[model samples]
Target: MNPINYLYLSALLFTIGGAGVLFRRNAIIVFMCVELMLNACNLAFVTFARLHGNLDGQIFAFFTMVVAAAEVVVGLAIIVTFFRSRHSASVDDASLMKL
Candidate 1:
């Protein structure tokens, strides 16, 4: 397996995630897409780490995963609150930030 293949896979995953974020109205789906993007990045990180014979990329991926976990916790809380108030998790309906 070539390292470039991993990069190609990562690119595909990122493209799909980006498209989902742009086109999906459901907050949960959008969130999952964002996670997909993050995992794609993680895959790239590990691939590069293996290629370079160093731990730096793996360390970065670990930190990224930690941050992503925290994001999931906070994002879900906000989404749940929005759903409770509006009875839906559509991104279009979350106008709480509007001035």
Candidate 2:
């Protein structure tokens, strides 16, 4: 398969995720969309690494996954805390948080 194809697929995934983040109101769905974007990036990274016959991109993707894991931990914690207080998980509600 051509590297350009992988790049196109990555762009498509990232665009879908961006649209989801922009249009979705639910916190969880938005979070998942962000994850989708990250995975799209990972896909591109791996494809390029393979094309170049090098491991650097794959290593970066590994670190990206680690960072994404940490993001999920902290993001879900905050979401859970907000839900506990408000009994909802809408991003609109989170915008009003003060202090």
Candidate 3:
């Protein structure tokens, strides 16, 4: 398959993720969309690394994955805590957290 195909797929995934983050009402769905966007970025990084014949992009992707993993841990914990206190996981309801 052409490398360009990977880039196109990455772009599509990123776009979908962005739209989900923008339009989704559920907090969990938005979180998943953010993860999807991160994965799309990893894909693009790998593709660029392959095309350039260097490890820089791959290394950057590795670090990104590490950070993303940490984010998942913290983000899920917060989500669960919020869910336990609030009955719903709707993004609109998150505004109540300000209090």
All candidates: TM-score:
0.93, 0.94, 0.91
Q: Report clashes for each candidate as comma-separated counts.
A: 0, 0, 0
Candidate 2 TM-score, true structure as reference: 0.94
Cα error, residue 30 of model 2, in Å, equals: 0.2
lDDT tens readout by residue for model 1, 52-99: 999999999999999999999999999999899999999898787998
Candidate 3 residue lDDT tens string, 35-97: 999999999999999999999999999999999999999998898988899978887987854
Q: Candidate 3: where is the Cα deviation over 4 Å?
A: 97-99
- Itemize residue pairs with steric clashes in candidate 1: none
**Candidate RMSDs in order:** 1.4, 1.7, 1.8
Worst 10 residues of 1 by lDDT: 90-99
lDDT of each: 0.95, 0.96, 0.94
Which runs in model 2 stand beyond 4 Å of their true positions? 97-99
Off by over 4 Å in 1: 96-99
Worst 10 residues of 2 by lDDT: 90-99
